[model samples]
Target chain A: MALAADPMAPIAARVARVRRELKDVWTIDIEVGSGGFPFAPGQFNMLYSFGVGEAAISISGDPARPNTLVHTVRAVGKVSGALTRLKPGEFVGLRGPFGAGWPIDVAVGSDVVLVAGGLGLAPLRPALYRLLATRENYGRIVLLCGARSPRDILFRIELERWRRRLDIDIEVTVDHAAPDWRGNVGVVTTLIGRAAFDRHHTVAMVCGPEIMMRFAASELVNAGVSDEAIYLSMERNMKCAIGHCGHCQFGGDFICKDGPVLTYRHLRDRLARSEI
Target chain B: MDMVQSDERSILTRAGLDALIGTLAARGYRVVGPKLRDQAIIYDDIAGVGDLPAGWTDEQDGGHYRLEQRDDNALFGYAVGPHSWKKYLHPPRLQLWSAKREETGFSISHEPETIPPFAFIGVRACEIQAIAIQDRVFLEGPHVDPHYQVRRAGAFIVAVNCGKAGGTCFCVSMGTGPCAKSGFDIALTELLPGTSEPIYVAEAGSEKGAEILSSLPGRAAQPAEIEAAEAVVTHTAAAMGRSLETAGIRDLLMSNLNHPRWDDVAERCLACANCTMVCPTCFCTSVEDASDLSGEEASRSRRWDSCFTMDFSFIHGGSVRASTKSRYRQWMTHKLATWIDQFDTSGCVGCGRCITWCPVGIDLTEEARAIRDAPAQEAKP
Candidate 1:
């Protein structure tokens, strides 16, 4: 077969490791060649699994290490199922580090609030790393995490280690948890009101299902946070991650390029509709 | 004459049309023109004037299109069909890339296309605008579609100003048709009045058009013939069978998204996506990958997609616009409302293929008017 006349061509990369994070969810560590592919924090890569298919998975690794890219994908469909089953040393096709990254510049020097639900944490993980690495540059950083149950929690060991730090305030929550679960029993939106952060100086970064973001954003708004300061990560079925496929158009904006991360103020009208 | 200035005009007899085709073929160009097929005039490969639907026009309305025989021998008398010029420029199915199984894993190969410049004959003014609109969508972005770029850059446009309007046509309201304003190499107006035989008052829109015109059998058009051609276009403009009220239309659609008018349309709409398939400017697409029986080699391809599909708005959980009402609203709002916000121009070119091809005969202009003219009613879920 002939290669596509497009920038959508993927570069070969080797899967270094695969860790089962939760039920039907995994985090794969991949490494490109010598120079190590450099990319921004919130950008994602199009991972192709041979004959199965391709999908957009966010880069979840530390930005400091550019060569080793990490992506966490849930086994929701065929392509992701194929990806989660790959063993170490297996090669995969990768196309990017495409799309806009989390706005670290605007979040800098301000109190940061990170809210993630279920697998949504994967896209925001790199931003959290940058916040912790430059801890002194930004104000107090709070991480509020949520999942379906205790077993669904991702990066369990890392969340524990982060809890030990005095600077990073972490709150964990789950829905329909077992009776013995010690974390908060309600949704993540409940965690926002009591969470400690200066409302005026805080920059809230949120990523989750569309409904969850809606409730969480409203809670933030009601809590005296301005819409401009809250950023939400938007996802669409992106065929060409560079924006030409037109699959990811959220109204006039191409969610792939104009943003995977758009300010609440910008997307407020679009987000309210049942369909846009 | 002096290299045929841009404003230079000529009279192209029936025989001269064939000579133009010969000129394009001699220059190694594939001439794609409107030909009668499947009872509709579709753009296809044509050898000469005989292939054109001479003396044939079309009657078009919502969910209606049928060929009609005309008294005159004028070519380029029909409205658009289910297919747009996009099928040629931006193809329906395009291979994005391929991954060959390697000893280690896969060796990815990039597919670059070198498309031969094609001569597009019998193109309408609205289609010229449609192609220009798609150019912005594919080319103006940070990522320019290489395939679209290759084909579009290589294309030679030969526009035909409408001498008759279809029942569904509202290109006049959209300010895109009835006459070719720009974005053409050559433009022709077929003037078949009561007195004289059929003649095309042709004008050179670009240097290439002038070069082609110089080779064809034509002479400087008499001043009276030019007036007759202008009269033909003016008559078509006045004879528009459909009209859309565009004053603040974008805001009207955006604000009334939840109006009961949407529910009314949804009741009739089947979500079959025929309108989008026929539209000139609906550019949404989806991609898929296929492998051989060996499973060692694979190729990915992108194909035309419509918002009416359940998967078009799909995420990991489910489709966002699952309901018929939501899907219909997305299509109309995107076409008339959000497209202006995205591309600084309306997505519609006023070529009413959607109305003509719609299975339910859902007229977008009528729907918009129903929403705009009616007093605001409580939105139904």
Candidate 2:
């Protein structure tokens, strides 16, 4: 019988541009034809590096600009390393816009608090861009970012430009800073106490390493934010973006489908358990 | 000649069995049935009734399976063997798609699937439930597996009622069955051997089954004869070798994640992955990519993966489930607890294949009972 188009098969997308974001991180802009790869803020794509393998990467670009799909990849593994090494005009296979994105809509009229750690900023960037573009749709907006050091800060130019605006509050920190580093020198959770936002009517979105997310989520709770008001972007080994491969399963949820973005209320019990 | 016809009740003589097999084969179906091979009854291509494991039954227990001879020439007296019906539907390995390099970019193309419509014979009630569970995984999801959809679309199922329970069988506790129900084209109950000859009480579950039944050499069964067929299943249900308390099982396992019982199971488990491989409802798979030496052609394929494997939960630096305890916990929890939350049903059909196939004979029922019998001091909090 004639088979239908495979959902797993990736469409070939040409690399529009590649910019080195850090020592081991690079952001690639992929051209996905004129139709535009429209996606929500916190979703991810399965990027296949030709002759190498596939990696799950969060969409790091502006959702407003759909034709140029942006993914910030860390060269920590074989597939991501292959993708980071690709030059402009090269081709990569793309299958995605998968998983639940951040609850930006739920944050309308409510104060928005964004917490990002290390490479975690990439996934949360789109939600930040959406909030900034609308500007008037939400209450007070606060962005707290943390990196390993001053050199590891992502989107430094953009963070500076956003800091220039009077409407939004921005805080940048480093875990271990050099003497020349002038910013706060502590983990991201330390910044949560001081950020100005209504604790009762606030929505928090956090993305980072598992340990960072765990502590950040607890700190947000201690800051009086409700569990349902907080969201965390989770990561697990994924093969099929469509939930066929069971690698990305976390407890009862398929992190690829039920979330990469999940409410803290849903993850409260599960997140506490180890090796789940 | 003055017999009241009943669609649900018909008597099939020994010759009628051959006629049923002939009817399916005539309809361009690759008839698959149980056969004696490698000292076990495994499902394979069957030509006719001669290929069935006649006068043979299987003795199964934890980490044990042996072929035994039954006194009567009963065609399907076995409980379950190593093979399940999943191999025909999901398959062990399948090529998802292939890609070719072009001057500017690459192009992806799917290999057109030509799945032969399968007619499975002698499927058990628990096996039918297992198929339904997998259906939820592959077809009922938001993204349907087109390959599995196609294979399942035209498939025909002929379910058989169990007359005798295996040493590891626990369908009664799982609420699946010893009697076929719901998901089948035709259901048959082999009547206990009487004076004259071997007879079967056949019932049609679908239109195709009815049509096929009409063509077979059989007569409308008497009311007493149908009761005899029902009695066969009732007797087998009471003979179950194992029983699991499924009440609050989801909460029980989730709450006891760090229980000391896990460490106990880890001590005995070899992490051989035999349970996951034998499980009929385990739908986990892994994708693999291969490229030609010239790098001109590349293909991606999906293969069956076991949760017991250290590589199953791999991330960037290392495998998440490195220890045998964690892997076993993941498998059992997913099957009993998380599965209901994910698919709205238990992942296990209580087929007992996992119990019989494990090298170390680690019975999940015993493990669960052990944990239930003695929870850690801090297991609740």
Candidate 3:
């Protein structure tokens, strides 16, 4: 396999450490160079291993922490499984911080509504942290998270901390729950009916499974949020972080470069495609 | 400017041309020209002018190609080959990204060296158009491919006017050939013996071409030589055995997406990717990764990928185009219909390289004709 000497290729990163977040899900924290990989919230990196293949994974670390890059991956395929088994001091290839990220500047003054499902919360975590760090810049911050079951819920400790904060409204829901569960037990979409929001002045950033985002976006729209004000993180098979490889193309736009974060209006038609 | 006679435009005699090549080699320019490679003529680096396929000519038709030796010993005895100008400019596979593990962490590797200047010897008019089309894709786009730009910027084209058109060639219909056009820096028309005039008409289309010509031993072409060049072009146009009716071809293919002809062709199509491999303008690729046995380090690379492959359109669980019919449809639709929407021009240059190189000999023009002639089917009420 010949490598095209790309100018935008990211430096090789090593898994300095690994922490298991859940069963089969591990968080690999890589220690890059001094000025760690600087990436905006919602941008993804293409991680590759020799013999195995490459995958587009979101950078889950806060942009403020540049030296330590973190990625929470579920072991599904050869590359992801190989990545999970990577020990401390193991080397892996990385290329990116590619694609348009969340519009932090635009969301500064508006009330932020973060809607995430399951592992989708990984990419949005950075944005949530960024907003919390600059708490005085924005209005009330609302985080509505959903998971398949009580056991699948991520960032449980952080969710509890956000709930204790005066300026944040955090809601956690699960599709199915045990008899011992005392918290909200319903689909994430059902909880949307009870939440109070200033739809006109709010920016809703949703991520997760495509079906979840679509249903969430529809719920947000019905609640009076405009399509332009709703942002969604799209998932696609991206081979090249650059626009040359046609794998990630949704019609004319290369999702790898043009987006992973796109306005609901921009990707409405493309998202309607059966397989996109 | 007064056009000189063809005999007067001899910057280098047949022997002098060989000497000039030696001079070029001494200067460090890798001189590449047409040579017999594999079973067909291909461009490769040559030590001298004698390396050129002297008396070999090719016969091409829809799904057919053969090479035969001509009695006359002409330097450029053959028509175009499967290889295009892209082999030098936009290579089939390039390393766009590389990364290596470091003590502190991992460091990504980018191309450190600039592309070396090269001299192309036997480019044709249709291929010039193909190069221009690629320029739009690589250069004019929002994100420029620095690798392609560097190589293309340093390339020196020596275009040849077609004196004989192949059976599958429809450059006349595509308005791309039979004669050297504007994109080339320098153009040449080979007028061999036995004709009313025997000469090689040469002209500079760019300042660099003018400089190269001034350095060489050529003079201004005569009026008769210019007329002879025109006659050769006209003769080649007349010799074209294949012609595509480009009149509303875009719309015809776009509207007839469900035509039964595509299924018929799909049955014969091998999906071997030979057509795309030989085509001058099909530019699709896929990336792969490689690691040492220990999995301590890894390298990611890209390779030429064809749309015909089952893996090309694979999404989550299965491929979007699972059947050979759908894959062929997508490839053809993207080439003839959707390409106009993406790029401003049609993807096919009517060079017929795809038709001749296809293992099953699936002819695009024949498929188009079949769809065009098919009767309209009524929808069920």
Candidate 4:
């Protein structure tokens, strides 16, 4: 409501916890100020590093706990490169809790299927926590995860704990692995076919590289899932997450405002094209 | 106060126009009007009536612009030029804020926004519509751009009806120009019937415009003179050189997303972005953070950007619209098709500055028509 204030003015957040996920990847938990805005599960934050630029990182923590904000960063660019090296008690600028998150309400009564690839797991982790917290709200829960290799797996301890739960079925695959590894060694779409689920009652949420998402969506389609039942977290160049900068325009929709999470029926045509 | 009444029309002599400029200046407003510079008429500081582009008209076509001498000293003799009101209102470069690293933390400071009230003279009807289109972009968005709002709020518009249509103009087709409608403080019509002394017919559109008109020497317009003023607008509308069909255009463009016509255009397009730069309504921008040599202080600034550039759509891996074919498709589809979906209006005001400024002489009207008239392609679903 305060249009007077500079929308570029970022609120300062203190880094409370920093956990190394893998090579070039880290999970940061920030102590958001009391005035910080509450975010939904799929929303993202523009994390700014002093002397460096900013990056749009999705909220990787639980949404129910409103005080602390969590984001996972890969050291790909100037901002995230600085972010991966940050320590506890350091400060970073934050602006948002932006974009539409996963469809928790729609997936409430139906069976839930979560598919994530590589670092794609970070954005969908919040939705997974929300689903686990309200375990009785949905039918069967199936999580299929894929990483480049065995050592690249994220949140290993948490995945083990979720594996122990009796109500949920979890399968993880690595594109390549060492000789000692004892799990599925193939691309993620293979797991989709093997996962046990009644296709008519299922709601699927997918997040990964664009190519991987395309292949996974095709696999889901081939396996009898309706287009409306499959959703994806899409990403493009994002500048002003509020939709004014014009960086995130995907056709008529600004990916930052209209979606980061959209149904397959909403984006399949655009995604099928090579460079849309 | 009756002199400042709404909808009052008056005839101002060529000399009285100078008084109007002096009156606006006395009210602490910087009066900027169009002047001939570098073979083009552009907005700049005005001293009086002598500073305007008098006795000069422009000839425009694809990839060409030249100034020509008019038979009479008509001030508003030409259609729109390359420079638009956005140069002052939304400005090409603006600093949002600057941050400096302090001893323990960082302190952010914003550059003081100092917007002087400005009286923009010689605004065309299509340019007015262009400004209103930009208003929807900068003001009506979810997060308003504060700097654009500041400059726009301080602007005083004096719109002029087109007296001559350039070779590339198509405002009649867009229904946005060739005549001034609303969104102006005052509307001006320059009449030159037979090379006699030029007289301006002024219509006050706002109380401020009327107040300024009250200070100038003018008289009530005769009924025949009023009809003559309307006739000037009618002639300009009918003289437009090009037209674009608007009915179901949004659907026609949106449905043919992958049409091969884009590739045909891409072969000729250098992607120099001259079209987007000259266009009055294109609002795309890129933000960059610049730190000083010491790397202690930095400011984030937003600059006008074009979608035709490869880097404009860059994400983590590479650009989204990488190919020239895709970039041209994105710009055209967004301007013609998806813009209707987003803004409920066409992005183009039909000024045709793009057609005149494009180096390849690639007219968008011709391109749109080619897409519509091409035999139904089986590949485009």
Q: Which numbered prediction scores highest in DockQ against the true structure?
A: 2
Residue-level lDDT of model 3, residues B26-127, one tens digit each, is: 766677778998878898888887897877889887677889987776667667888987877777776654555557655656656555567777788888
lDDT of 3 by residue, A203-236 (tens): 9899998888988988898888888989999876
In model 2, the runs with Cα more than 4 Å from the true position are B1-6, B195-197, B376-381
Highest TM-score scorer: 2
Tens-digit lDDT track of model 1 for B105-163 = 78766655555679999889999999999999898877778777777886888899998
Q: Evaluate model 2: give its lDDT.
A: 0.90
Leading candidate by lDDT: 2
For residue A111, model 3's alpha carbon misses the true position, in angstroms, by 5.2
Give the DockQ-based CAPRI class for model 1.
medium
Give DockQ per model, in order. 0.56, 0.64, 0.27, 0.55
The true-versus-predicted C-alpha distance at residue B165 of model 1, in Å, is: 0.8
The per-model lDDT (C-alpha) reads 0.86, 0.90, 0.75, 0.85
- What clash pairs does model 4 have? none
Interface RMSD for each candidate model? Answer: 4.3, 1.8, 5.8, 3.0
TM-score of each: 0.96, 0.97, 0.82, 0.96
Angstrom error of the Cα, residue B183, model 4: value is: 1.1
Report the Cα lDDT for residue B35, model 4. Answer: 89
With candidate 2 superimposed using the best TM-score fit, by how many Å does residue A165's alpha carbon deviate from the native? Answer: 1.3
Q: Order the candidates by lDDT, highest first — what do you get?
A: 2, 1, 4, 3
Candidate 1's displacement at residue B243, Å, is 1.0
The per-residue C-alpha lDDT of model 3 at residue A219 equals 89
- Colliding pairs, model 2: none
